[model samples]
Target: MVNVIIRSNEANAAATALTLAARDHHVCLLSDKVSPGLYQFSYFGEPRNEVLRAVDELKAGAPVIGVVFAEGEDVQAGMQDVLRVASPQLMVIVGGGITGAVEAAEAARRFGLDTSSVLQIGAFLFGGNLSSVRAEKHDVLAGFLGPETPDHLVELALATFPRLSLGNPAAVALSSINALFHVPPMLLNAMSVERAESIRFYVEGFGDSVCRLLLELDADRLRLGAALGLGLVPVQELKARYSGPDAPKGLSLREQVNTLSSQTAALPSSFHHRFLRHELRSSFAPMAALAAAVRVDVPTISSILRLSEILLEEDILDHAARPAQDFLNLMNTHSLSIN
Candidate 1:
């Protein structure tokens, strides 16, 4: 049996890991704060612990691999503990942003593990109650650096998620679409979001004007991808592919919303969300830095960063600067996979 250990922060990431477990694969889910067994409180704070108990009870034949990390525990470091328990023949999956991926890969190398043993992967992990994985084909990216690559691990990942393997570390890092999804909606619909009404951010909320802004940011993303020799697809195209043509099709980002999304109007949510904290930092910061490096102007991304500065109430770009420098150091040091 190909044992798999998924180190994740968001419960949805752990929940996604359980899909493999349901298929009779040995899966271990490590996370911070939240218990792995799933005890969710309702919107009105009503109890739903019975489902959790039932799940645990039935998990005897298919035991639920639930692990709750200590306060302030690092997800990647948790892998070391799992390594001692289950020497997974498949791989240990590290899910995070570009900087996180680099650090995880570096940590694995420090642990004396090879490429065949681990594959670092992540995407737009929208956190809190909003977290979800698309049933449609979405763009998730993967990266590894070594002389001898593991072919089977990549295959396993493809079998698991709708992922595209970007052979270059830089390519994989640059391909994150979280900022594109999060920043635009948060900014454009700030008033509506602040009102605390349900806004179908992707489906109904992303009107023409918002999409235009996203497209502007996307132009720079594509440019950055081109500079690094990576063929990156825009969020609009990714959504179109995921939703299928039968849904709806439009010429531009605004137009595509009518056709590309399955949701007409979504449940109400708040402006106080992870979009600014996680998506902006992970997705936009790196691109803005790279655009400067390549001499490519990215006004939209820069503008979003400034707005994010207001929302986050801190100088956030400074946080990503060190990682960008560290990434530059890693570029020359590690091995690149050709596949």
Candidate 2:
């Protein structure tokens, strides 16, 4: 059995830990404040129960499934702790945009971990709450952070996530759809969000104009991907793919998104929500920086960032500078052409 260390006890992380545990892997979930012990976790939609054990409870000598998915510092710290405690067979950074992936890479480098053992996924494969997670079954794009990741590691990752597809790390990172999907809606619906109006984020917030702008931003992302010689899928197509068998087809991108996202969330009550913070800071800003580095003009992305900064009262691009540079450095190391 593989001993897996997952960072954060958040919905996604908890659900992932439970999924792995069900697969007979001894899963240990890490949270900064949560105590170490076995906790009863229930799965909804399909009503089931699973036990999530603490990190301290992992048995010695078990093969480690070192896949981690968490926010910025949390992921780095979790990687450090896992490296210190276990002889991880593989280190997977599930999803945190390019920034989070770079942070994981840096952590692995600091520990002198083999670059081949480090993997970066473009996004999470599951979606749901802390109590339960439904596998979205999206085509998960991933790649090694360095020059070469082993075939066995690839097999293990695919075994863990059957939908996972190996690809360029930069392409995988750039495939993130959050910035293209979330930012425009949030920006357009700012006042409603601030007012705490109970509105369906995808349905009500996404008007024709907002959808048009979203497409423009997506075009920029695609161009950036092309500049790096990676063919990133459009956000609409990605969303449709994630929607599974019953996914609507031939609809406008907006219609497809609104229709497929039957589980649309309510607009956040404040601009302080991670919808803005994560998508803008971690996703969009870094993409903008990459665009600048490659001489790709992403005017729409830039405008969104500027507007988000004005709304949030801080510099989004500046906040993302370090991660953007780290991403560029990683791409350069891979010898990818910028021209």
Candidate 3:
């Protein structure tokens, strides 16, 4: 049986769900510890050097197949390093932060191992009164399948910027492209000041991290624009789900709403682009990337979320919401099913 480890602040809930699911598969608890062996590890909260050490220990005992970060970033580099150098079958899933995932993906690609998967489950909108308490948050996870994250992610970067290079352009483009994974839902949340502020700090951190990464690469103006152009990838996915399959419909989940709020603030022009339909075309790829992080709430995400409301002039909270896709690709879907 394949060993499975699940970790999260919401551990009880995840454990409950996994217990039911594990009846059909071998599920091993990583939180308390039972044995030294190969396992599928999952957890949330801040990343720590100790966690990396524990992971190294596990690898020392047996091969690790996949890892799920519930909510953290501390040991990201260490985790990525190990995934690159030691285990090729490792997979990682994180919440909705772009910086860590980007670095991980780049590291994995550089290592030449191409079978990793990342999943951005939901948005991290902090303020608005949301409908369902459970819906307000999500569990971010990762699974490793090889020396590096799947080559498909790199392909996605390329597809998002057919005209850009794999070097500087990829760095900026990937940053923009990954940014959207965190915005749309947060806009709809509009919960409260404390919550918004909390999420804002995270957003700022992620944005700064991406910007810093680009600066390190010496990314130029055009590269940034190309990255911005990549931002639309996640927005379009949001549009397809809530806005409408074809006509850019109104928001759809009023029934599921637990709370509601209204805001009348005007944002800077640069920030306003997330809501504009035309701008969506420009942000094509970055949006998907932002969603693929360690945590899901942030400010750039709020800007995008706010834009949707501004452009549509409609309350997204008062509509029928559909189920969002669970995985980005079928391979990811299947990987989730593996014992």
Candidate 4:
């Protein structure tokens, strides 16, 4: 069994730790907020017991799975903490936004860590919250931020996640399904967010208008990807791929999204919610920056970014521009072959 160190918080992190523990891996769950000790948590309503330990409790060289969902400074802080503690043989970044992963890789460099050992999953592998989790049967994209190589780290990652497949990190980042799926619904339902109404995020929120906007944004995303010489799977295709065998056949984007019965359907109470703030700042803003660099016009995406900035009363696009440029520079320096 792998001696795993899981840096966790929020539903995805908790659920990931629980899933690993259930699989008989020696999972040492580390959290800044959760108190250190043995804890019993449920997985899909079944009682499962696992220990939630502190980072310092980690062995000198265990593999760490960083289930960081936070963006910006939080991503840097969390990743630095993990590197400081275990100096892990392999560090897997799961569920963080595209820019969050870039921030994490930079943090590793600051610590003199071998960035080639860092692997990032394009999305979270599960579909539920901390109270319970249901494993997603879809394949996930993962790749090193640094130069590609065959190593024990890759083997360990593959063993841990059987559905994982290696791909170009740039493609993986640009292929972020969250930017396509989460942003439009949140933008269209601004009044609901302002009112703090508790509507189902997908089932009730993904109306015809939202789907139309999502399609337009997704088309621009594809264009951006093509400009960068990357083949991006359309958002509808991605949803179908992730939804696995139960996905309805030949459904439109709206029909497919609205029919996702297993989705955790709670709308964010305010604009500050990660669905809005994080997606715009960490996901779409960076995409917009990259699109601009390549002289691609992503009008729908541009519109959403402007609307989000107006709603949030901040300039997210400008904030993301420098970092996005830096990310492209890093990819070039490492010979990651973006084009």
Q: Summarize candidate 2's per-residue lDDT along 93-196 as a digit string, tens digits.
A: 87777777788778888888877788887766666655566656567778888886778887877777677778888887777766567778889998998889
Query: In candidate 1, which residue ranges exceed 4 Å CA deviation?
Result: 9-11, 31-81, 89-95, 122-139, 155-166, 241-252, 255-272, 333-339
lDDT value, candidate 3, whole model: 0.31
Off by over 4 Å in 3: 6-20, 32-64, 73-88, 106-231, 234-339
Candidates ranked, most accurate by lDDT first: 2, 4, 1, 3
Highest lDDT model number = 2
lDDT of each residue in 239-339, candidate 1, tens digit only: 55444446454376666565433344452354346655566666678667766766778888888889878866788688777666656555545542211
Q: Positional deviation of 193 in candidate 3, in angstroms?
A: 4.7
TM-score of candidate 4 to 2 decimals: 0.90
lDDT of 2 at 313: 88
> Which order, best to worst by TM-score?
4, 2, 1, 3
Give Cα distance to truth, residue 9, candidate 2, Å. Answer: 3.7
* lDDT (CA) per prediction: 0.54, 0.76, 0.31, 0.74
> How would you encode candidate 3's per-residue C-alpha lDDT over 79-184 as one tens digit per residue?
4544443442434433323333444444445656453443322222121111111211211112232224456654542332122222221222223322342233
Query: For every candidate structure, what is the RMSD over all alpha carbons to the true structure, in angstroms?
Result: 6.3, 2.4, 16.1, 2.5
